[model samples]
Target: MNRITTAIAVLVLSTAAGCGTSRSATGGAREGNGTVTGIITLADEVGPKTGDFCAGLDVRVTPTGAPEEALGNRTVRVSRGRCSYQIANLPSGGEQLAFTVKPSPAWQCGNGATPTLAPEPQALQLKDYQTETRDFRVSCTAPSAETSTSTSTP
Candidate 1:
């Protein structure tokens, strides 16, 4: 009797543990994909200083979410002060998309302080066959760090 009771309890527990709801809070494992595209400006005052805004600039895309399996980090080179980026074939899930822009030492792309992502990471829920648009900006002013006479070369 003891052995039978233990076996029944084990089975019941196992069955209960294995049970899962048919619906997911965020609508689990969906089909289809989505895309995100945008552009970034180097800045009004900084464009001329750099001569070529498209010369030395890069933008990176980072995805933060669960086992998306479709999302990944993407890096793009800015051209003529414009950044057109796209992230496609994404699984239906929650994602915090982030963008960061950096310029080469030769070319300055930020204000007196430093360059930063205009719009921080955004929380978005991607739907099947959906496309989203986001635009970024990079501006600048007189170099702050270089104001001093510290002409130290890296």
Candidate 2:
């Protein structure tokens, strides 16, 4: 072969070899691999004059259908009304998992009544090692049957 032709062939082969390898979450798996992380935020309420119940809330996560005895151990702090969490080492597939978070309880509303309760026990679904981030809103008002009695003389 001519020297020019040989040089061109070498360059082509070198470039092709480098192009094949790619960096992905699962080391370039067909479905891919990566970590999933998310943050939870709350929207301020303005109706009924209820106090901020979600501020400094505590969130708990537990794997459902695991076992009866293994409940309420893992917890995520949502202080300042925000929380962030992550799920790692996921495989490739359309798999779904359910998790629940118990937000810190609020005490009272503006009318000297019980504070409203937010939504509890949230569910999450994941697919094909998908890295997803989502937010949840709490809407349930605190039950009036329970009220706080804090008396202080001014």
Candidate 3:
């Protein structure tokens, strides 16, 4: 009778331990995920482009204080002027990240034009299981004639 009781106690304790471990693992997996979404537009002085002028552009997100191999760094391509990205299972609590829109070589305003991001690289605070929206606009400016001119020496 004594040996049977001891074995039963051991079995109960092991089952309890297994349950606790599984619960913690499941909670950790679901607690700290986040999503970032946005619309990206390309325009000249006139107005925003109507179609996929901004397609193939890259939107990048990187954690502020983490290494290159950190869990939160993400990048997505602009599709029809929209960017949607999600990061699952980041560290618990929240993280600060930098969002940037990388210009595409195909973008052009005019001859010798320069493209620029309206808000520049942005810093955002993201919380666990939260969704954030950040919109971006790309504008282009033609180089001034004087700056565009190449001086000729006779």
Q: Best candidate per lDDT, number?
A: 3
How well does candidate 1 score on lDDT at residue 12? 92
Model 2 CA lDDT for position 84: 58
Compared with the true structure, model 3 gives a TM-score of 0.56
TM-score against native, each model: 0.48, 0.38, 0.56
> Tens-digit lDDT track for model 1 on 24-54?
3334443336666676665654444434445
Candidate 2 residues 34-125, lDDT tens each?
23555555434422223443444544332346423222223344445455555454433543345544444552333443333344445554
Q: Which candidate number would show the highest TM-score if scored against the true structure? A: 3
Error of 3 at 14 (Å): 20
lDDT of 1: 0.55
Q: All candidates' lDDT scores?
A: 0.55, 0.46, 0.60
Candidate 2: worst 10 consecutive residues by lDDT? 66-75
lDDT of 3 by residue, 71-101 (tens): 4435554465444444444443565665556
Model 2 / residue 80 / CA error / Å = 7.6
Q: Which pairs clash (backbone N, Cα, C closer than 3 Å) in model 1?
A: 42-138, 54-80, 110-140
Q: Count clashes in each candidate, considering only residues at least 3 apart in sequence or on different chains.
A: 3, 8, 0
Per-model RMSD to reference: 11.7, 10.4, 7.7
Model 3 CA lDDT for position 130? 75
Rank by lDDT, descending? 3, 1, 2
